[model samples]
Target: MDGQHYMERYIQEVVRRLPKGQRVEIALELQEMIQEMLSADGEEVTVESVLLKLGPPKELAKKYRDDRRYLVSPEYFDNYLWVLRIVLLCVGLSVIFSAVVNFFLDPKQAKEAAMELLYLPSGLLAAFGAVTLLFVILERLHVKFEPSQSSPWNPSQLPPLLQKKAVISRSDTVVGLVFIVLFCMLLTFAPQVFSLYLFSDSKELTMIPVFDMEHWNVILPLILASMMIGLVDEVVKLVTGRYCGAVLAVNAVTNLCQVMLSFVVLKMIPFWNPEFFSWLRKKCDIPDLLPYITEEAFSNLFLGLIVFGTALELGTTAYKSLRYGKN
Candidate 1:
């Protein structure tokens, strides 16, 4: 096999697996390696020659795959990051999918299902957050990450709550309860007057079937259940907040449980075109109107949350900034 054929086969395999940037670099490097080997004036560097030198394709692929950050790292990542990766993957996929769905769905379907279906992500956050809690517990039980063995990222720097400090305060518990109740009220009643304004011009509401009474029975319970969940979340946030210790992880769990519950209600209820829900619950899914919520709203809400978490974490940067830096 000529040197050209030798390089072609190796290059093809490398190109197929690598991202374009890395592939270019690796290709250049391999070309250099091939040229150097060919000119060495020892064994003739043919396709067979290079093939014998570079080792098997499988071995090369594994080396390349291991060369960078792994898709799932059982080594060095420690269980916390490992769990985080899974959660992040799930939430990212769901967010993307929901965004796509909302983009195309009729605006009417989006509104009816959007706010109430936050339960999906809430559930995912809960499940993964629990895994994180377990990892924390293991650390408390003296789990060690050995250099020789692959372990989750060391969680020693994690907060006292996450790192086994009894930092959960009575004040946090009370405040969480208060907000949960407040949220319940807001979600359930939602100032129907306000909603009426928001929906006044919506085509879906406007195009309501002339004989719409039948679907009301199916949809109304979903609306009601959502109100109840705000309360549940408040209580959960209070409890999870104190226990999990990692503020973000706790919020994610609290949110995830709601998301799961949202899915259950959306799946079980009749409000979203009873016929469609009926058909989908059996054959597919009555997914929430994920795409309906404006990305702007998501961003704003996420920002607010980050601000709130930071307030708790940093003891109110705004207050400090104002007191020390401002008048």
Candidate 2:
């Protein structure tokens, strides 16, 4: 049989066991190699001769089978993953609880006045989604190899456009670095305003605002905190992109520190405890609500929600990182 006929049979033999996308790509590449090797004017290239020249079809199939276009790790997470959920849940629950309590404590007159300018949870999701998209796009366009060490799964070299950008895009790089620094600054000091929007009241809208601050104090700061947390998440993505697997463990400790500190501040305040109630009551007129908040029932529910939430986020992030982390 001719080279064309040989290639057709060879591809048919090899494509069945592979994934559809993988099969198609291998078939197309193999067809091209065969055509390049034996043009129409060439001596007859039988299936046997072509097979001999190209090497065993099983070996060829094995090569392609071993390759990975995008890393596919099993959804495996250990202790580190659970800790993240703990932190996020704790912070979310505490903030939500604080907002609800502070709002209702105000008189009904102050309620309507502040309703127009409260924090909305939707704003937090939007900010997080937007920033995370930025990283997702960058990850897709990136080259996966250095000049000296490479694989077929990795591009042999960076594209001309990316090479040019690397050589001459100092300003863009500097600006990106600057923005990252600014985002971290926001995360560290005042994470509350990241989601604050001067949202105009609309006839079509019916959602109630959550915070009741005098100005944007409640709405703005809560937004900032959500955005800042999202920023830290993106930072984790960026750092982990270069080194997957064990490298991400750095986040575990940092997150634990922040979560532990927040838990202490929220839960261990002496004045909120009735055992120290007399000293606190005389000092600043310790409110009944503060003591109530420390009660076992309330604390357990809040802590449970926090732990559950943190678990969900950690599972999510771990799965996501495992899928997209390695370049």
Candidate 3:
């Protein structure tokens, strides 16, 4: 490649590692800097020599970011903010949803519904703390979105411009993470809410608890751990913002942990409330349903579904990683 091609390749490699919004502006600045350096050298210095003296595109990109002083660091800051926004959105929506549900359930208790709004600030604070903590851990571990700094880089090693398909969607990852967080929160704070609500003849509302509280309490930590593994997996996706072997490996490992934890939870005991089935059968007048959908049978069915879902996720992630990793 000639001087122009060399410069373009170098600029592309640097900016492509950065956020999309800043890429154009940074590319222009880099081009101007390279031109100034070339002009200063007159006709004696080749573009290759100039680039070599400037060092690798990766290092130059770091200089452009000037991200050395922070706990999370600049490279990961954009993603940190992205995750924070999604978490806050999820928290806010949960508060609103809770308030709305309470209001609909009992108009006389509108004051109580209004009181639920107080949880908003606390929820947002918790969300911020969780996201910051995750980023800090990543930073401490030196988890990098860019290629590792241990490798040598040269002008010839300039990576090609990123392809469209190689990019992971922030929105999609956010949606998935929001669901995971909400599910975790629901189980932790209000597991009993997963109940069958009924209206009695006297217009009294009745809630039949789904899971035996004793059993749920016993297994809650394991379930939360499983969910946390999933949370970490999504964090990896957010940081990398693209498909790669690392993402595939993390996905596989986390999914496997989730599978094992889920199996353990299912095997420890039947989670269903002992009274729930009897009440359900009485209410529905379907005593025969017990034979077909016993606790053991339900546990087996749930385990099978979890295994199938994990397999599907691993397969999809593998295909995407391999297809885009080459790019």
Candidate 4:
């Protein structure tokens, strides 16, 4: 190959593995170095001989990438792994739950259940990719990972040595915030996606909306408020690293509002799709399923479960606040 062609090819190979922003600059630097090396010989040096002295493209790329090729840098690697594991766990659980639900809803759709399982690996990969991408962005932005940079360290703000149980974990708060954000997005943009669907044909599926959309005018605002409050509370917990009296109070108020809203929404509207049971009966020819699958029964059961869960969460929060308030 001609000297210029050889140099261009060699440079292209080395730069291809580097970050886009640094590729041009690195290439120029490498070209300059090669020219200097050639001129120092006091004779015309062929690109082949210059490259022979410089070594292989892979080794050159490696030298350029030293300490810089990591998707998540050392400062954030632990956090990145932690987030990835949690996200993958959540994704796995979600996939399993969805598969189980689908199986129960339509036992004939065995392929659908299997497909959900098949999706688990892809879901985990996607979660891993997303977490890695986020950490990469943060790494590039030079986010400070040091405790001093994160928040003011106050020895007085620390909980008592005996009250180690009072401390809130930042990781837990972040994971909760992530779940809340995902739920909020689902509720706001794709509420129907949560609904049960029946496969009418190989290529056709019929959806049954889970919630009464007519009551959405009243429900959406309440849901949005509750989710926003939850998100804010989690963010505060993440930032503060410990729950103070003020944080506990805010959390209590938000939980109360959420519980109250849940009750009101359940009372004022039937959440289970009105047509769901009827459609199931007509299409599946399963009369025996009627007694157990009544819409009212399902709605009441769902509401009761929500109330119980909310009340349990509230009680736990209150207990924690009281038990550790002095700390």
Each candidate's lDDT (Cα)?
A: 0.43, 0.42, 0.81, 0.65
TM-score of each: 0.29, 0.28, 0.84, 0.47
Model 1 per-residue lDDT tens digits across residues 223-272: 44653444343333333322332433434544455555455444443323
**CA RMSD of each candidate after superposition:** 22.4, 16.0, 3.3, 18.1
| Candidate 1, position 3, lDDT | 48
Model 4 spans > 4 angstroms off: 1-162, 280-292
Q: Report the C-alpha lDDT of model 3 over 1-327, residue by residue, as the tens digit.
A: 778888888888778656567889999998998989988989888788889988887778787666566777766788888888877887788777777776776779899889988888988898899889999989898776445656666677765545678778878888789888888767754565688888999988877788878777677888889988998999999888788888998999999999999888886666788677777556665666757556677788999999999999999899888987653
Per-residue lDDT tens digits for candidate 4, residues 1-327, read 357766776786566556556788999999999899889876866667778777766557778665475666543455556556666776677677667766765679878776768777886787677667766766686643212224432222223433456667766776786697567545654466677676765846667877777677778777777776675566445433445565676677877777677766666665556776666667665667667677666767777897788778767767766787454
Model 4: residue 282 alpha-carbon error in angstroms: 5.3
Query: What tens digits encode model 2's per-residue C-alpha lDDT throughout 59-97?
Result: 466566543343321111111123233333433444454
The alpha-carbon deviation from the true structure for residue 107 of candidate 3, after best TM-score superposition, in angstroms, is 6.8
Candidate 3 accuracy as lDDT: 0.81
Judged by lDDT relative to the true structure, which candidate is superior, 1 or 3?
3
